[model samples]
Structures are given as C-alpha cells and as structure tokens.
Target: MSTTPMFPSNLLPNEASPEWMNKGDNAWQLTAATLVGLQSVPGLVILYGSIVKKKWAVNSAFMALYAFAAVLICWVGWGYRMSFGESLVFFWGRPAVALDQKFLLEKAFVGMYPTATMVFFQFVFAAITLILIAGALLGRMNIYAWMLFVPLWLTFSYTIGAFSVWCPTGWLAKAGVIDYSGGYVIHLSSGVAGFTAAYWVGPRASADRENFPPNNIILMLAGAGLLWMGWTGFNGGDPYVVSIDASLAVLNTHVCAATSLLVWLFLDIIFFGKPSVIGAVQGMITGLVCITPAAGVVQGWAAILMGVMSGSIPWFSMMVLHKKIALLKQVDDTMAVFHTHAVAGSLGGILTGIFAEPKLNRLFYQVDDWEKYIGLAYGLNSGRTSAGFHQMGVQLGGILFIIVLNIVTTSLICLFIRLIMPLRLSDKELEVGDDVVHGEEAYSLWGDGEIFDNTKHYTEHNTAFDLEDGSSSMKKTATEVQLT
Candidate 1:
C-alpha cells in the first residue's frame, strides 16, 4: 500500500478552514448532538422495548424510532425556524424552511459554528422532546394517531416552548429565565404534554395497566445506562462552544446523577426493605432532569444538594402522592413521565433559582449585568436580594408558561387527530397487542435443532420462566402461551 496523504496537495487555503469558525467547537457540537441522538434511538428504543410488557415491546420501541425520523424531516422543513428564527411574537418564531445550502453554510446567530451544525444539534433536542412525550402515550395509543401527533405536536407545542425559552428573542429569555439546556423547553414540556395527551388518548388496556412487567430487566438497564451516559452531550453541548463552562456542566451533570441515584437507592431500601433497580433508575433520571437547568451555573456542593432532593421528591410524588392524588391516577401516564420528568424538571428550575452562582451565570450567559440573573442564595449574601426574587419569579413563570402551553397545545392536537382517526387502538388491537398490531413479537425461541410451529410463540409464560433463575440457557420447551 502506498503511504499517501488523505487530502490533495493543492487544497485551497480557506476552503476547509473557514475565516470565522472554531473547528474544535464545531466538531464537539456535532459529537454532542450525535450522543444525544443515541440517547433516543438505540437508547430509548431499547429501554421502551424491554421495559414494557412483552406484548407491547414492538409498539413502544417503534414509537421512539418513528419520532426520531419524523422530527428530523419536519425540523429542517419548517419546525426549526418556527422555534429559533425571527420572532413572530414574544412567544413564537416565524416559520420558514431551514434547508437552503447558502443559509446552512453561514455562521449561526448564537455560535461560531455553521448554521447547519446548529440546526442538527437543535433538531436532536426537538426529536428527543417528542420521544419523551411518547413515553406517556405508550401501550394504548394508535400507531396512525401517533404518526399525526408527532408532527402536529412538534408544530404547535414544542416550537412554542423552544421559541419562548431557548431562542434569543424568546419572551422568557428576555425575562432572564435560565434554562441552560432544556429543563423547560424539553423536560418539563414533555412531561406535561405527555400527561395531557394521555388524558385524551386514555389508558393502556386494563390488563396491561394492571400487570405490565419488563420483558428484559438486564436489557432495560443497558438502555438506561446509555441514557445516563449520554447526558455528557445533553448538557455539555448547550453552551454551543467548548469552554470551562462546558467542562463544568459535564462534571456537575454526572455528579448530580450519581448522588441522586444513590440517594434514591438508599431510600428505596429503607422504605420498601429492598433496593429496587427500577426505583434507582427513576432516581437517576430525576437527578439528571433536576440538574439540567442549573448544571453549569451551580457548584459541586449545589449539584450534590440538588441530587439529594431529586432522588427523594420524585420518589414521594411517584409512590405516595400518586396514590393520594385522584388527578394523577386518572391520567394513566404509562411511563410515569409526569412524576419523573415534570416534577423533577420543575424542582430543578426552582433550585436553579436558589443555587445558581453569580459568576457561573455570567460566564454561561455571557452577560455583565449582575442584577439580572443572581440566584437567591448569592443575592442575599451579596445584598441584591430583590434580584434573586425576580429570578425565582421568572423561573416560576417559565414553568407555568410551559405547563399551560403544553396542556392547551397537546389537547388541541389530540382533539384534531381524533377528527380523522381514533386516538386509541381498537379494543381488538389492545387485546392482541404487537402480534395483531405489527405482525411481530419481540422475542422467540427454538430448540437445539428444531424450529417451532408457525402458529405458536414464546411469552412470559415461556421464556420468562427459563430466565428467572438467571441462567444463560434459553431452552425452548417451557409452558406454551397460545397466541389466540
């Protein structure tokens, strides 16, 4: 083989090396976006598939995969502009296609990177938001209705939240609300929209709601692991440039998540008498959500403090309050996203108001005004107490805006989808599940030298029994569960 250079010797001076770009920042932004994308594709896809009952494995996983593809198409077409383009109003942006080559090659408004990179990164965030909303509607939502819901919700709901919170001209951004990544635009919005959609789509089938069990606990953990690790990008990339703030955000993100997981794990062991893996995962997620808004603005001690609360508050809401509150029980959020994401996100936003350091906020916001963004803790210590109260009020306003916006937009989207199609799966489809709905099953088994009958399939009554003892072997002959 010849040892030759990859690029041509006569390559132009400025063709690849742009006059106004930082290659490292662009590269990191792309990598960060891809990591966040992984959190949705294989990450969420695997988690949803293995976490649901065996019958719903295909449907649950497909919803995530489909949303990822659908949102990308819509995002480039018009959704992106509607989210971050010229302000149509205080709470919205004007819609336009984001697919022009001339436009994509230019420097982005907010970063030193090309507009194309910004679009791609923002699209991943938008896609994941839609995927999280799907978490609430899983198991009973009609596939066709979901297809409509994704694009419509992207237009009506997600765009509004993204525009109002993250966009430079957004009303909330102008009001000094700080959502470093997507605590408001993504998490709190998804949680509320999901719960509202669940109300309109109704619950999973009684059988599924009563007794759904994870088909593969180990596989579920693997997917959750991907999500946990993927946050390096989720919070790290929000700064749009690699700097000390990005590094600090990444460290704080992991520290908070780890602390919250341990706190929640210990809480479960003390209260329930055993450390439940599922509960620990929930805690891990809440910790991640709780710190997202303040990851860069908080110190190590603040992250730890946020973690402790994240691990407990969501647990109380999920375990005790969910039982006492009739409204929560009535909605039937299949994945409990309302508790894990909505509650945790709101908690994080409030805590961000409390613990955000003045120095870090200035670094992240690139602002010199000390009065505008001081956290309550620092404000009191520094004698700018009113500014801190103002920041906290803005935080609450952002939360209230998100909750109301999602409820209205999601309800309308559901009602509109209902006009053309039934929002819920048919009774027969609900009863039969993936086989009848998708003509496939998540798992199958064959003997050492033989294939099974075409009419039969393995199930919880079959493969689950084999795996219950933690055996590696998957012997085919167990009690049969008839498809009919």
Candidate 2:
C-alpha cells in the first residue's frame, strides 16, 4: 500500500499564482472571522442574555462568552493540531502544532489552499461549535465545570469529527463524503453533544419557570444580525482559499437563509396570531445551520428546499414535537440546539445525497486524478445528468457515524465530570447571576454609585426590604431589581 503524505508538497494551484494572494479573500477571511467573533462574544452573548430571564441573563451570557475565550486558547495551543495536523487514526487527526508563518503561507492540503487561511478558517468553526453546545447547558451549569468540559470535549470529540470529515486521510474523506461546511462536524456533533450535556446537567430553578421572559429584545436583535452576517465567512471561507466557488458558497448560504425566513414567517402567521422576533431569529439560525453541510455541493433550488425542511421541521421539533414527546421535554435544551443544529445538520447531510451535483463535487475537489474522481463519482448534474446511490450512501454513513459518536462521548464526559464535582451550581447562586461567578456583568447603566442593598431601590417600587428576614418591611418599597 502506498502511504499518502500529510502535507501536500504543492497546492492544487501552482505555488506562485497571484490568486493565492488575492488579498480580497484574505480580507474576506479576516472580516468573516471578526463577524463570527461578534456572533459568539456579543451575538450569542447578548442573545442568551436577553432570552433568559434576568435571574439567568448574566449566567447565560457568561456561558457563551467563556466558551468562546476558552476554545480559542485551546484551539491554537493544541486543538487545531488534533483536528488538522495529519491523519493518524481513521477517525481523527494526528497531534502537532501549527505555529509558523511558513506553514500558513503554503498550500493547505493536496486538495485545498494556503495553510494559514485554512487554520484561521477552521478555528472559527471549532470555536463556534463549542459556543453552540453552550446553548443547551446555559443557566444551571457551574462555570468551573463548564471550563473543564470545554477543553475535554474539544480533545475527545470535536477534533475527531473535524479530522474524519475534512482531513485528507480521514476515512470518510477517503470514502468520498462531502461536507461543504460543517453539517456533520459543527452542527450535528455539537447539537448532539449539547443535548447530551444538558441531559446530564438537568434543569433551571423552579422559580425561573414561572417567569422567563427575555430581558432585552434590542440586544437580541443585534446578536441576530451578527449571526446573519457571519455566514459570509462561515460558509464562504470553507473552500480553504479564495475562489469563485467560495463566492458561490456565500451566496448560496444567504439565499437559503432568506428563503427559510420567509417560509418561517408564513408558517408562524398561519399558526400563531403574531410572528415573534424570537421565531424569526430561530428561523434565521436554522436556515444558516441547515445549509452549512450542503452549501457548495447542491443547486440553489435544493438549498431552498433544505431551508423549508430545516425551518419547518426544527420549528415543529421545538414547538410541537418536543412538547408531545415526553422524553424530549425531560432534557431542557436551553436553546433548541438539537433541533437547529443536529436535526438541521442531519437533514442537510441527507439532502446533500439527493441534491448533490457531481460536477460541483469535481469543481470543489478540483479533480486531478480523473480516474480517482470518476471511480468515486455518482452521477451528473440536473435531470439529464446521470445519478448514482454511492455518494448518497457515503453521506448517510457520515451522519450516522457522527451521531453515535457524539451521543456516547458527550454523555460519558458529562457523567464523568459529575462524578468528580456536581455540574450545577447551588440553589442560592442560581439567583445571583454572572456577577457572582465571573465577577463581570454584561451591562451597567449606572453612571455613579453602585446599586446595592444599602442604596435605595431605583425605578418603580419605592421601598426597601429588611435585611434580617426574607420579608418586605417597608410597605412602599420599590421592587426594581438592583442593577450592578
């Protein structure tokens, strides 16, 4: 058997091509990274802050923020190596640091582009996947436990999925599977892991259930916009180098998102009296996530159809199906990660089988060994184009492989962490918010003195409570919560 080299001696394009230095794509990559960064830091950060009740706002934001920071450090230090370094195991990458500028400037892999661009591009995917998982375990999980879990899960789970699907030597890659973006690695894996982690962590406080309205709608909208714009980089950058197809990928991603949003609005108007901003945001995210795996592979029409399934099916799962299914409601997935990521990702993977055009695949892989490409080829594009089942079957195998892996691994890790220390915070801390745990509050409107027990309450109610008992001593006491 001939062994394949880890790093390709030369990229698919010659080493001196000006397209490699297009600077436009480079700018796009940086812009995309910044946009994606915004999604986690302020985007998901504020969205979670607003969606959860005030009591848990800080906690929710902290969960997302901490995961973002923690993943970056781990990614550059070690996680990146494990995912893209080399094909060691059939299912995972070999471990090695990607530190020098030399590696970045060179071609990424045999079939890809500049290594540096690839590294930064893949880092965003890794970071976001972890952040996505944070959605499920937000309110109740201990910050300390979460800190430990992030790195552990990255090492044990995230890398394996990345290597298997994207790395050249990965079994799935060799088997001719396609993931234009991260339906399998980012969405599907994280969705399953998120749900499993939530199952292990349990639910929020009883009091939180009685009143859990969003604290700030405007902030949530800002977050939503960031998530929407970030797709430019998320899917666009997947091609590894700046190219025409990368542009097509970005266009396709947005088109799918727009179509899904319209369909969702239609569904909401038909069923509910009003279309909720929350519903719109959910539709937007599901559309984006659903198109991820199939972004560059299928036709634009296929993307629209995938969006419909993504928006409707996940909406149903979150709205009706989860309520009807007793087992699903048992695990409180704080933000419907399973529906948006896992279900949508899986559906995208399956649709890729039905809708994928082999011509697109050839264009993506930049077929050099025509014999090899032809050997693995399924069929042609459009109705006139011949189709085959082999490619579709391979795609299905990837979905199943990732699902089983995530479920088993995430559960084991969470259970193991629980054995060492309880995953949830105490009853008292749940009410205290992020100020107590991380020593940081997301928003502070106060211009002067600290808002504390000693200071008189501001806004509505004009009364103070007695410190000794849990009773309101003053009859005219203001009930506005002190904002610090």
Report lDDT (CA) for all predictions: 0.89, 0.76
Please provide, for model 1 over 1-484, each residue's C-alpha lDDT reduced to its tens digit, 9 standing for 90 to 100: 9796565553323866575887879899999999999999899999999999887999999999999999999999999999999989889999999999888988898658799999999999999999999999889999999999999999988998999998878989889998999999999999999999999999988878998899999999998999999999999999888989999999999999999999999999999999998888899999999999999999999999999999999999999999999999899898899998999999999999999998898789885564588789988999999998999999999999999999999999999999999999987678667876787777775566443432224444444443333212223233243331
Stretches > 4 Å off in candidate 1: 1-13, 368-371, 448-484
Model 2, global lDDT: 0.76
RMSD, each candidate, Å? 6.4, 6.8
> Over the full model, what C-alpha lDDT does candidate 1 score relative to the true structure?
0.89
Off by over 4 Å in 2: 1-25, 100-106, 110-114, 369-387, 439-450, 453-484
Q: Write the per-residue lDDT of candidate 2 for residues 267-301, one digit (tens) a residue.
A: 89889978888888888888998888878776788
TM-score of each: 0.91, 0.85
